[model samples]
Target: MAQDVLESPLVLLDEVRAGLQGGTMVPYLGPGISALREQEAPMAPEALADFFASKTTLPKRARGNPWAAAQYIESYRFRDTVTLWMQEAFAAPVPPSPFHLWLAGLSLPLIVDTWYAGEMRAALAGQSDWAEVQGITRAGIGEDRWFRFYDEEGTSIDADQAAKARTLLYTPHGCIVPEANFLISDADYVEVLTEIDIQTPIPEEVRQRRTGMSFVFLGCHFHDQLLRTYARQVMKRSSDHHYIVVDPETLTRNERRFLDEQGIIAIDMPLAEAIERLLT
Candidate 1:
């Protein structure tokens, strides 16, 4: 029943920066990070749902819900159709924001990106010490694997090789590059959710890296139940203290409650402003 304290951005700036530099803080990025660049890609679940709706007629109930809209498309049109649309929606290459570039320069052990965009991978292109692991859907794949590891070149690599990297980038929702692996539909999430609570779907390397590490959530909002659940499971067994940059005036009652329950301190500010301060 505790409330998350609204901390002054200036007061926590130094400590947050220090944590990033020391690799004690993991960067948890969301789709909103795409707003840093002027791109045509849908940056949020609602927007993505609209994109699907525009492509094909959707039921009124599925109009604004991405998972439902995607489910409708897969159920009616075909899973391949849904995949093609997803690939087309995120086909445009998004240039990395300054914050992403800055993070790439650091030797952080883990960075969790929940979005499907390849901006993070783009940012790390020049870094040789990093690798990525993305969550794959269980819909079409014949294998029973839940995730796949890739090197800097986008080549598939074993988990052992990924674990040896100095830095690791984890996209729990999948990514566009290398292969178009997306967990957007309800079926995709249902399959993962069944085992996520038991940590069966999470890569072993990610589990080991997240232990005892603090998280800095950038451009993320946990207003939706699905996102809240994923964030909770991903941060499970990690450090108690975490930070999320969000606008105090725009937060819903549920969002505030989620923040409080998770022991996350809220920094009231614009995402761009927060990034500028963090970079400075």
Candidate 2:
């Protein structure tokens, strides 16, 4: 319960330290973090418009709300353009943003992100030298599909390397191994939300093994359904976690109020700036 906890900057950092000791804290990332370097990446509104154009075979609109198109498509086409775009976007590699670098500096135990592949990998590549001990878990398609990835063909981030580095990255939604199985689409997004609801703050077993834990959230826009699902899960599970959510624009009054109310420390800064503050 947020009410039972004391909300202060120093106090919050102390809570993060406590989670480090207790191993209950974890980070839940979102799409905004991807934009840390890809400033050219289309905004959510733009992505929505593009999705509509792709679905209806209509010309892309110069200016229009993408969510409107999303609503229309959901009601009409029921296609997976939004999901496709994310998969394609993440499939390609990009440079690490500041937020990613900041994360590298922190020796947190475990990190959970909604990122697909590209930018995060880029970030990891840059931070590989500093990341002596870390673990990452991703939500893949299904348990069977995920195990197959580890079994049939191993990953570039092998278990040996992971064990040596003390890192355990996962794609709970399935990785590139079974491209088709990678969860996407509005329904897949919904499934991610469902998982957050059911099994989050991660399980206790995971926490005990993880040490110096604190969730340093980066680049995530907290309003999406998937994010909200994670937020609710985090809120319900533990108040001892640390969250540093970065956004380009400063939070609106309502947004600030909401984060303050929820006990989430919202960092109003660009991903580059956030990384600068966190890392070098």
Candidate 3:
């Protein structure tokens, strides 16, 4: 089908809702989703970069880049300092949004959260059928592993154990809870990015669950190349048709191109408005 024919917001919302109820649409959440909460958690990359800069002096080139700022801190102060900052930045509790609660009720095979906050885990706390698979940084660990699995109680588990859960929460960028595992600095991503295209870093459970599923991208922006690349690789081998709720007027040229290239239908509306309609 042509992109123009699928540009109807009402029609797209109906399809997305149906997909959610039917368990074929995975929710791909971004950091901006944290903005729905009243509390502050440095939701955006730029905001996080600024937060790091505030704590330590960063060169002008790394001012607004979270990865660069983190790299600078890791190089100068040490990796422990970077982890401390991340833990402090996300220490405050952020209540889950309505969408999170709605999703928690469903029997989703997989949910990809690309941020470090613990709200998603909190939202799923009421359920016992879920587990988390997060990307781990290769800085200090002597083990040759790229990811870790944790059951609802946050105890470390094997991949076989995680695969048995009805719902799997995949955090590609790591989270603050359970353990302070973050992939923010330049060195952290160097290994993951190198193998992401080949699906080496992605867990087997995630890859199998996402095989024939569609994705509903919420609170996501693809203006940066790194963001675009991660989205592309994560959704690789999934169903062709996907939906991204975005304000058409605010899309960057690169973002628009990415949507077109990825067979994603852009629903033009505010995030809150779209979420409201999705719930209805």
- Candidate 1 stretches greater than 4 Å from native: 1-6
Give a tens-digit lDDT track for model 3, residues 80-133: 999999999999877788788889889799999988887788889988799999
Q: Which stretches of candidate 2 lie over 4 Å from their true place?
A: 1-27, 39-52, 55-91, 98-102, 105-107, 125-165, 170-181, 191-196, 200-213, 234-236, 245-261, 268-271
- lDDT at position 43, candidate 3: 87
Could you give candidate 1's per-residue lDDT for residues 3-47 as a string of tens digits?
344456777766789999999999999888787677788888888
Error of 2 at 112 (Å): 2.5
Cα error, residue 89 of model 3, in Å, equals 0.3
Residue-wise C-alpha lDDT for candidate 2, range 1-280, written one tens digit per residue: 2342334434444554455345456655555666544444443434545744654654243225443454454445444544455455445444556655555445445555554443443445544431221112223323421122121223333334444443333333333323423443344445445555555324333334344444556555554444455455544534543566445255555554546555566444455554453343
Q: Which stretches of candidate 3 lie over 4 Å from their true place?
A: none
Ranking by lDDT: 3, 1, 2
Clashes of 2: 17
User: In each prediction, how many residue pairs overlap at the backbone (N, C-alpha, C within less than 3 A)?
Assistant: 0, 17, 0
